[model samples]
Target: MTVAEGVRPEVDARSLSDADVLAIRADFPILADEGLVYLDTGATSQKPRAVLDAERQYLEHENAAVHRGAHRLAAEATERFEDARATVAGFIGADEDEVCWTGNATGALNTIAYAIGNASAGRGGREADRFRLGPGDEIVTTELEHHANLIPWQELAARTGATLRFVPIDDSGALRMAEAARIIGPATRIVAFSHVSNVLGGVLPVDELVALARDAGALTVLDACQSVPHLPFDVRALGVDFAAFSGHKMLGPTGIGALYGRRELLNALPPFLHGGSMITTVTMERAEYLPAPQRFEAGTQPVAQAVGLAAAVRYLEGIGMARVAAHEAQLGARLAKGIAAIDGVRLLGPAPGEPRIGLASFVVEGVHAHDVGQFLDDRGIAVRVGHHCTQPLHRRLGITASTRASAGVYTTRQEIDLLLDGVRDAVGFFGVRA
Candidate 1:
């Protein structure tokens, strides 16, 4: 369905009214299930009918291996595939040649790490010298990074004999900017960080980090998994050298994600996965690969998934990202305030009035996170439990896990309220008192 089909055309798309949001919710078939309050959008979003239909249409009518065949179907498939690339590029404010499709955000991050490792091993030759790392060189990231961002760097450091460092976070899960300044110095070869904390929900200062990386002559890699789908993001505006985000978290299918890099950087970096569909020419002894994206995309591409992601991007654009940010801000504030008022509940990330995305992960004293999650699920309120793939962040908080209630565009105030009520009941039921 068109974005304007169910929603009121008279209303400005920049401001999504309650009626407009409800109308938008009608596009998701899963939400039609009665009493189902899905508050775990941070984990993965419910797919819109538009995204589902887009993938289905491609699979049923236009399925063919992209850039490999000479027939009409193959030609049409290749056109659709490249068009999807263009659409994704536009969404992230990147050039068409800068975006590369991957299996997921983890794979995307690994792609950069492995490419750097290859450079250190002298795979890309003199042009890839920019990516080389050595004993004295440091790869700087933050303690708040998801494992997907952190572990890859760790592996890279090990493989290249480089040191891996991190900007520390305080007890409240906020990044220590002063420490970050001190830690990220001339030795840093790369600065990788999350755009938003999946655990804490606070937005990181991207421009500030970019400036630090620039001064250090280091490349900046952004984990935009949490920010791109919800915020009005521009990779060029943020000035990051590379970024990675997933389709599943942004209202599209799983097994599809993207890595965006500056065209020059991507072209200079060596290919991570080597196989068919990415090479320009092959000799019995040696092979030469294509440019940035093609060199990275080896084997069969996820044609249907890419089309679905493009559809998801268009759907978000229809509602306007500014409006999405505003709506989620309101929900974040409500969640923070409500959780703060509940005895024995400790809210993570920003304070009640502080800026954050529309997600709250909190610890309820004397209750295990899994117990809380079960209670919420019993009441038809779904939330994320455990470390949210941020074990280091959780360890810093002195907790093993926390229950996270995250919102989406389709989420209503009532849904947040229901989540809050569920948490309250969970506390009471578990006999947890402050």
Candidate 2:
């Protein structure tokens, strides 16, 4: 059962032998095919061969329904599944029981929102009454939120009779945290926002925001969908009440994500979906649900995807998270500087660029975003183009869409140079001026 689990290897990335990096990249078959420069890690990362193999090995050798049968294969499957959960929990600095699997980050966020609504309808236990609210209560978010993060809270507010308030971003599209005190005050029941803005790449002052919400006795939710895969994240240390993210973004298979919540809060909240496997016992009139995670996971789980995600976490651990963050910082700084030098490119998120990631959304003056994307695509540079599911932020920024070039640890300086030259060419093709 001891398959070299539960540890992040301790080695400075700079001090690592060249062979180490080569071996790491070699484990990813997709990296061997160098036809494309993937600047869309914010959407999803390329999976390593190790992760794919882990999934295949599980499906081939240990396939079974987890935690139900007395058979040996079932036990093996359940152990691996729970081990994957433990791996994910450790990566995020949470207890294994605190993590619940959902279809994706979108599913996790919606599950939380729907659970809150259920609690408001007198479904959750006594401790959940604090989360239940009517008029005068508020759910606070940021203008720079992804739809996965924003829509759920919007629905929660809609159903609970609570008002939805948000911290507006400045002209540069960064969260105006200086005005956080003014925007988030009494009556703010929940303050959920993205740890890193998907469009801006700016890291919000999460610790400060969590502190504010903690003091206000409000629940705090953080969308780590963009941050967890690329940065160091300790959910407990961050003091966020709940954190949600997708596996695909971390180089794992799709249809798998995790939601971390405080045990007490989760035990009190109701399940978003109810059916087989979540209940302890059921009568014709009433039924009792399992605690926390089991209560949340109601149907057949994504066992193979969990294994892939565990493998992805191991991949990240072998590389070291600090190294990933440092690597991304270098690339992000380079891209930001280059984009700034461009005549007509208007950047989204933070302009001055402080503590940011590789996510950079920019508008090519007078050119449509689709055209920019097509130009980049023709050059084998894959980027995300459009409103980026942050339509409100786009509206506030006075743009319909923008071209986003996000980065990952595997992204190289040569690829960035390609994007730089490609963007200039697109600008020329469109005959745009600053």
Of the candidates shown, which would achieve the greatest lDDT relative to the real structure?
A: 1
After superposing candidate 1 on the true structure, give the runs of residues whose Cα lies further than 4 Å from its correct spot.
4-15
How do the residues 244-281 of candidate 2 rate in per-residue lDDT, one tens digit apiece? 99999998999999999999989999898999889999
TM-scores, all models, native as reference: 0.98, 0.95
Residues 185-276 of candidate 1 have per-residue lDDT tens digits of 99999999999999889999898899999999999999999998888889888999999999999998999999999999999999999999
Error of 2 at 261 (Å): 0.2
Top candidate by TM-score: 1
